[model samples]
Target: MRLNHKYFSNLNNIANSSPQGIMKVSILESITNGFHLCCRSFEPVASAHILKELDELKTKTKKTIIEDVEKVKRLESEDRNALNRAVGIWKAGRDAPHKDAKFATDASI
Candidate 1:
């Protein structure tokens, strides 16, 4: 697959000079390069799964951003109850840190 010179040139400009930084940047560039290759390579036999996943990601991202904006607006509009509920939920998650950790460890085991 051919790499895009323009993309690599942009990456090159932003990339740090350190070996690890360069390697990290090159890996990202390779993925960006690979995306074009994959589209071309898989065009003939592409499944609906890829489109479905992309759509799902788009939907979830939009929903998350919209909800965040709504939450901010609610807070700004002096909706103390809604703000308190949101804070309570956030704090509950933080208070249950060990629950998530144990669940992850249990799943791995």
Candidate 2:
């Protein structure tokens, strides 16, 4: 929470660079630079392959979501109609020859 307060208080741009903040930033920068150095050789090829695959995956995911949404919408009215039919059937069951059996009066679809 302290991290959140510090971050959101200034929209992630710290107003004051205290000694602690400076040290933290320096450590982070050093780590980032080290990683960058390690990946420098493969950065170009790996980035191109990874980004293309990521874009393809994103497009497929979006298309699948759209299709699922349409399917659910089509089923929604059918589900409502089925529910109404079930309630009507249950109401009809009241006519059976069982004096002790009772269906709730407040059942509404």
Candidate 3:
């Protein structure tokens, strides 16, 4: 457990050492208590050009999560058949915006 924390801290410090560094990394573990040992580790490394691909992936992931939550909300508030029809229409191109469509995005979503 001590070793895990040491490594995680080292990695985080190195990743954020640069004056203009923006990347973030984290590792969480609680096996010594009840969580888990280094169970969830998020380490992302990329070059200048690969950053664009990472951004695109992040956008897609956010969109998917948003749509999934919306679908759950709609299911809870509206009829299943109606939701299905709306999805079908959306899928069939009813001149609606794409689910993963990009819009002006800022930190304040």
The alpha-carbon deviation from the true structure for residue 81 of candidate 1, after best TM-score superposition, in angstroms, is: 12
Name the regions of candidate 2 deviating beyond 4 angstroms: 1-41, 84-109
Residue pairs clashing, model 3: none
Q: List per-candidate RMSD values in Å.
A: 26.3, 17.0, 26.0
Whole-model lDDT, model 1: 0.70
Q: Tens digit of lDDT per residue, candidate 3, span 12-89?
A: 677578654443333223433454433433223335548888899999999999999999988877787878889998
Off by over 4 Å in 3: 1-46, 79-109
Q: Which residue pairs clash in candidate 1?
A: none
Query: Candidate 2: lDDT over CA atoms?
Result: 0.66
Candidate closest to the true structure, highest TM-score: 2
Query: Which has the better lDDT: candidate 2, or candidate 3?
Result: 2
| Stretches of model 1 off by over 4 angstroms after superposition | 1-47, 79-109
Expressed as tens digits, the lDDT of each residue in 13-40 for candidate 1 is: 6676655675456566557666533444
Please tell me which model should have the higher TM-score, number 1 or number 2: 2
> What are the lDDT figures for the candidates, one per model?
0.70, 0.66, 0.63
Q: What is the lDDT of residue 47 in candidate 2?
A: 88
